[model samples]
Target: MKTYTVNELLKGEQLLQQVKVNGWIRTFRSNRFIALNDGSTLNNIQCVVDFEDTPEDTLKKLNTGAAVCIEGTLVESQGKGQKYEVQVERIEVLGTSDPETYPIQPKKHSLEFLREKAHLRVRTNTFSAVMRVRSALSFAIHQYFRDNGFYYVHTPVITGSDAEGAGEMFRVSTLDAKNPPLTEDGKVDFKEDFFGKETNLTVSGQLEAEAYAMALGKVYTFGPTFRAENSNTSRHLAEFWMIEPEVAFLDLMGNMDLAEDFIKSVIRYVLDHCREDLEFLEQRLLQEEKGKPQNERSEMSLIEKLHFVLDNNFKRVSYTEAIEILKRSKPNKKKKFQYIIEEWGADLQSEHERYLVEKHFNAPVILFDYPAKIKAFYMRMNEDGNTVRAMDILFPGIGEIVGGSQREERLDVLKERVAALGIPEEELWWYLDLRKFGTAVHSGFGLGFERLVLFVTGMTNIRDVIPFPRTPQNAEF
Candidate 1:
């Protein structure tokens, strides 16, 4: 007999057909009703077991987390929670779980408790729903880019380049670490290494994508990015995924429009296609915030927040204007901000970004033209000689979700900026060569894939969105 999934069966289709199904038993209530789920959907199929007909030994194996395959006839259910169920004829246990030692139970498990069992957490309702949404969001990203005439670029994961210039790199070396080859100048020799030069995992793919964008007109890269920052906060991860898109002949304003439209499109896609999973996550977030104080709870539900972003226009303000506003605002004036905003050159912190989005503008806001001293050297210098053409998109709950700028296309100006910033020019000779050979005005932005999922799924920590989080001092699988 052909096999069927729980999702296909629950669609109220072709009733009374013989079927074979495989799933794990979620609950064995009264030794007759087996709640089985195959991870195809959030809901499970209730399998009615006949105690008098089935052997006692086979019935004893029906427990929580036990994998089983069942052959039965579809029938209408009288249960309170579900609509249709399967009337079981023959059953076989694919795998058995000891109820006495199984970590996951039928009751709700705390997110903290679930992280420890990362391998098995997907068996639960919460993680399963989250992963499904995550999978859908990835698809939406590719679809949005593909439909818009953007070519996908597969950038290298390991490189001899430090694109960010922040120097937070995980060195990719194949030489002896304790003691090995040394140079005559009394320094470790990277010349004899595996690649014949020093290399590390890429922190961002923007530079490589820019090279492709100039050739392909429009290109994007969605891949893994690595960093070695020793941050144990709920926000930082050693490994994460980044979505970067570069376009030729696009300026800062056009970049802003593309960013906003792209974000809303993918979010709307998830809202439309993953309705059942999103509904489950929405209810989950609602229940989690019940015990918190009214002031501490989320102002809007998950779906409400998603809809607000889709329907609203992101407020745009120059960095200078934002500074003046912050200087006169209640947070700065009343001495409430942790990093008090005082002058124009002050880099905006999470606290400041949150205030602008949640309280000041009361909507999603984009701050642009940041100080040249704070932003990267690749950003095009403004006419004022003090600010760069950089923009950061800030959301209400999460502070900054997107960061990008118009890149410097002038060869002389870029070389001067590179030298002034004390960044090595020879290592980035190819990067500078792009400007030397027919460089046109181009722009791109980088978005953290996990952060977008966090905003959509109502997940708090960054680690929860990833499958196996690699953090400081925690690499346990």
Candidate 2:
């Protein structure tokens, strides 16, 4: 009379009570054996049904992907293959799936093919497990922040000022693009735009979150951020979610500690709650086809790496030190490095970041105090005058998963920095006003949510973690 989850059936117990289960047939071997999965868990329930007891017409109507409701008695499995199974008493066909029409079958389908059916791909083992892990990770993020006394803040999606000032934003306007409003000087008149000014999708919510954090003492924003870059790489996505946490009265070191703790908490939560889904991925998805054993390490490895890096007070080196290390290592000797790391002011590429974290440090490495010329204007300037107190957390597999810095709380410093960067000071009046009124020392970091999911799940491509991923040229359903 009551529905039993597939995970509940996994326990070895005989059921005296009647149970109803609804799921799609994963694999049906002959008339008596059917493997059904309800999206409740990674493991499917093998339902043993006798076709002779049921109608032959019903057996003929059943196919893979067809929805079915089974009233059955749960019993211990005597079969050698599986642990427990369900003995069907009454079978009801809720929906029939045509064998030829259903794209998903028992046979293997390529990842490219699955990408085409992004909506339907969740039914597959790999995507299903990924989605579950993604959900768990999101919950963990909120839980970690909430438990640590952080207020959740929602910032505006359409913003007038570019947070990153990287010129990568999708313009939102109702004005004609061919012959837009213009002033007598022939300059595009932003006053006539829909919002009476230029507005685009927010690239990051860190700046806005900082204002709230200064008031609330601690605040975080988890929302979708947009980037209009046209690079069609595995790592680049047109739209992605970002988790930005800002804390008042916090320095760069405190910011890094919060990031490390947040990452470890999410990793621990997923590994604890989604054990079945992760086990399925380890056994079926990430494993080699030849049955080569995948390296299985305890979940503690994630926390261990985080603690090891945090405990050592991450090797704080200026951009100059990084360059020196690169030079001494003889990066030119390695033919694999695309660009030679020579000068002090070179923007650290992904290759260089990976080299620092994976090779040099042999652990998670936090590279801080970047050259002010390369970093954003809001970053606090160091005593050295050239470098800013910006920090980037680099892991072994991914280069820069988290990026953050202490804000220039001083109004004079912020205004000077904005003027030097040639950014319009008029557009940033409200942001500057925050400093003018009552700005305390504050720091924050932005963690790319998709990248975090990829790192925890061991997913290689960014596209795999996000459902219906919006890449440069790809926006297929």
Candidate 3:
């Protein structure tokens, strides 16, 4: 007997051949047909049983979610929904799921209910399709970087430096929380901590990727990063994976070109390879949008949306220009935006970013040359003494999918900026040393992996894309 996955059997020849198949039952119909899936594909293979030959007790064990092995003859399916199926000659129940206890059944379940049972949510069609597309996108990332002569760099997850200056880091300590060591002023002494210095989970890998990029020429980091902010929004996650690529001898304009090419390549890869999964998700999205008003629904289908980005060039504009447009727009004059744009230096909010990309441009927009005071400390200072070579790529629905800048290459300028931001000069000595030694024109950008997933899979919540989401207070497996 030969073993076969549900997907393999479904694609096999029409001739009757003995095959052994193993999978979990999705649904049992009329006590004769079994819809089984092994996760190789979204489609399930039908297993028709001869009730006359199969024992009554054995038929009762073939409940939904039951694990079973079957020896069957693969032949053309007589069913209307499928082309090929298995005519079982023998069946063995490896595990049985009780109809009363199994959380997953043949019925429509809410996304909230599935989230509560995340451990078993992958067995569902929606979660499984999302995961498959996520995996494909991840592979596409590695392949894209590798094919483009970029090295995959692994940065440390824990560090003493704060890359983003947000100070929303999760402390990694082993000392006693109730009563720890104290200093002379009765303050909690961090000198006695595990690392001999205060350290937390890293917020970004861009700084470290820059260090490697100087030597390697081209480097990218794909790993988990953490933030400790207590945000319960659908888009905010305490822990998420990040993709950062830094290149040597590259300027701000080159950085934008690289980002556009990289994003389009990976998205196109998913479109070509994950067609079945995307098609399933597309239909699921159509069903979901039926509940919403016509104006709120997406105008383009999922496939059309992906192709639109690949075919069109992203609109580029300066931050100063964007500010002027926002100031004169109807939203600002009507006071519709929650954070109205009043001046040039005001930080752009999500609503503003969406309005720029969706309404003003109707395409992906790249806004560069942001105010230095509002951006990070490492960005290169422009000649105007006000703006930095910073850029943010805003998508139609997603506000900010990418953020990056041309790093400060001048040793004195970088030191001054770091000191002015109140960051410890000693903590980032190595980062500064890059400028001192042989730092050239280098630039990099960070893409939130989950947000990219949300864009491609048409998912609204960031929690739904990640397998085990680590949010404000929820860490359940």
What TM-score, computed on C-alpha atoms, does each candidate reach?
A: 0.98, 0.92, 0.98
Which window of ten consecutive residues has the lowest lDDT sum in model 3? Answer: 6-15
Error of 1 at 10 (Å): 0.9
All predictions: root-mean-square deviation over Cα? 1.1, 3.3, 1.2
Q: 312-392 in candidate 2: lDDT tens per residue?
A: 534455567878887767554675578787678889888888778767877677788899999999999888889999998
Instruction: Mark the regions of model 3 whose C-alpha exceeds 4 Å error after superposition.
Output: none
Which parts of model 1 have CA positions greater than 4 angstroms off? none
Compared to the true structure, candidate 3 yields what TM-score? 0.98
Worst 10 residues of 1 by lDDT: 11-20
Name the best candidate (by TM-score).
1
Candidate 1, 107-202: lDDT as tens digits: 989999999999999999888999999999999999999999999999999999888888999999988888869999988899999999999999
Q: What's the lDDT for residue 185 in model 3?
A: 100
